[model samples]
Target: MTTILHIDSSARPGRSGEQAHGSHTRRLTARFIERYRQFDSRTEVIYRDVGAVPPSPVTGGWVHAAFTPPAAREPWMVEALAQSDALVDEVLAADIIVAGVPMYNFGPPAQFKAWLDNIVRVGRTFGFDRSRAGEPYWPLLADAGKQLVILSSRGDYGYGPGQRLEGINHVEGSVRSVFRYLGVTHAYDAAVEYDEFGDERLLRSLADAESATDRIAQVIASVRTRRHAA
Candidate 1:
């Protein structure tokens, strides 16, 4: 059975109509999950809400433990790396990953960054080979052939290719870069923009984003079906 890792990094919580309004990305991710379940009932989902309960940031000791060889590591090192190990295991087991990311100050939120720090570890997701003259940093996790779907919610518009705010839009680009480094090449994004401008533009953007989510869900379902058959 295909295993999907669903992660939501939106800080907002509660219902959309509530005083503590939920984020657009959270709603979009829910829509995607609903459609995905309709496509395949047998699929298994592993959900992680980083925004609600963010992982601890990597510390100096954590770094030392990660760099140390497993065989030579002490019990303390092993304990220090337990969380990161679990996070990497989840990714390695997943065939697909769906992440809900809300842009915060032109970049990903602290919760998402903390998760990234936990997952990207030496001798785990990636490997370094100094003997290989060039291109020493090789990704070990690339062989999994996983697909990544990102649901992004932005307050402003023009963040796409050749757009006015493209240069400043670091959230999407940084996400792509980090995943690409870990061997995830098939990445897709659906974004809801013009959120700060609460008007017809916001409504239109939400509609378009919902449609994009539907399309992505369909594509993922089709590919999964084909892979399973093969």
Candidate 2:
């Protein structure tokens, strides 16, 4: 069975507009998974909701425990270290990852940032080899053979060849670049622009999400087929 890691990172549960936007992404991803499952009953989907509540930032103790050898760790260090290890394992076990990341202000929410910090560890997702000079840091998550699909919602960010709000689209680039650094070569983004929060705009956004769901399903099927063929 192929495993997929599904993640959602919008802060609002049912209160804010951003939450509403993320809900659309969540539904779309679910639909995509359902479509994928129809063809492959053996596929397993694992979920993580960082938006349920704010996630804690990695602390000094977490850093120490994460970097230290497990055999020499104290009891208090065990829990934090274990959490990080489990998160890493989840990422490693997945053949595909679908994540919903809403734009907050100009970037992702703090919970998403916290989630990223937990999974992106030195010597795990990346490494620094002293033997190398200019290229001291190297990627270590290369063997996972995973693909990432990102769904994002933004406000007032128009898309075009020469859009004035080009800077606001940095979130997409950031997600792609960081995941690439972790050796995720196949990363794709699907975004719905909810710049206007009117009822008409909302409906349009939902329709776009429906289309995106179908698109994702096709992508998933194609990738799984290629994997099996290989």
Candidate 3:
């Protein structure tokens, strides 16, 4: 059975009027997961919440431990390596990955970025080799065989012509590039836009979110069916 990893990176709790972007993304993710699980309960699902309170960025100790051979690692290094290894292992095990991310200051939040940095490692998720020169790059994540779907929340970014927040494209582009760099070539992203607008616009955004969730469910089901057929 294929493994799916679901991640929520929203810091807010339910029913808050302040309404963070990640909140809507999280709701959409939950609905998608419920539908996915109903279709295949036997498939493994791994759920993680980085927005609830994510881990800190990797430190010097972590860097040293990650480079060191496991047998030679000191106790302190072992502890640091354990935290990063567990997260990286989850990514390695997953066949499909789903992430709920909200744009903060034109990019992903610190919490979510921290998780990304932890999982992406040199000689782990990817590597560089001088042998091929122009294309000397190699991927350590190739064996994981994973695809990705990202649910993004943005305020006032239409992803179309002449939007003031057009720069928001960085969010999607960055995610796509990073995932592809890690050997996930088949990745897709869906977005829920305009949360900062007042009541009417917020309601519209929610409606868009609901529609996106439905579409995501359909896509997931179709992909699973195709995989099963193969």
Candidate 4:
């Protein structure tokens, strides 16, 4: 069975139209998973609500613990790396990751950023070897065939390729770049824009984004079916 890791990082806990001041990203991701379940009833999902309880930020102790050799680590080192190890395990087990990360100040919120920090652990998601002169660092997840789906929202608009504000938009770009570094096979995204305006444009963007999420679910399901048949 396929496993999906669903993470919602929006500060808002409710979905748009479901509650006052709700989150669009959350709505999109929920829809994606809900629809995908129709195609594969046996699919398993691991949900993580980072928006409600953000992961702890990476501290100096975490860095030292992560960099140290696992066999030589002290008790304190193991304790320091505990949360990161669990987070990395979740990513390693999933075939797909569906993240709801609303743009905050042109990038991801502090909670989501902290989650990223916790998962991108040395000797886990990535490997480092000082002795390997030409390639000291490498993505340990390479050839893992993982996929990341980023459901996002923007306060304004124009954050796609060659769009008016593409150069400045860091939300999806940063998230995608991080997963790529970890060797995800594909990174997909859908976003609702004009949130600050709250005009007809916002409504239109929301509808389009919701539809995109459904389509993404279908695409992934199709791939699974083909693989099963093969």
How many backbone clashes can be found in candidate 4? 0
Task: State each model's C-alpha RMSD to the native.
Answer: 1.4, 3.0, 2.9, 1.0
Question: Candidate 4: which stretches are off by over 4 Å?
Answer: none
Clashing pairs in 4: none
TM-score of each model, paired residue for residue: 0.95, 0.86, 0.85, 0.97
Best candidate (score: TM-score): 4
Candidate 3 deviant stretches above 4 angstroms: 15-22, 129-136, 160-164
lDDT of 3 by residue, 133-174 (tens): 687777777666577888887777576336666755677677
Error of 3 at 45 (Å): 1.9
> Would you list the clashing residue pairs of candidate 1?
none
- Local accuracy of candidate 1 as per-residue lDDT tens digits, 1-230: 77889899989984243334568888888888889888988788898899899998999999999999999999999999998898889988898899999899999999999999999988888997779888989888788889999999889999887999999888878988988999998999999898888789988998999999999999999998998799
Model 1: CA > 4 A from native? 15-20
Better of 1 and 4 by TM-score: 4
Q: Give the count of colliding residue pairs in each prediction.
A: 0, 1, 0, 0
Candidate 2 wrongly placed segments (more than 4 Å)? 14-22, 159-162
Q: Which structure among the candidates has the greatest lDDT?
A: 4
Backbone clashes, candidate 3? 0
lDDT of 2 by residue, 65-169 (tens): 877766788998888767677778888889888877877776777887888888888778888677997998877777777888887776654642277777666
Please say which candidate is ahead in TM-score: 1 or 2.
1
How accurate locally, in lDDT, is each candidate? 0.88, 0.75, 0.76, 0.91
lDDT of 4 by residue, 80-161 (tens): 9888888999999999899999999889999999999999988889888889989888897888878899999999999989
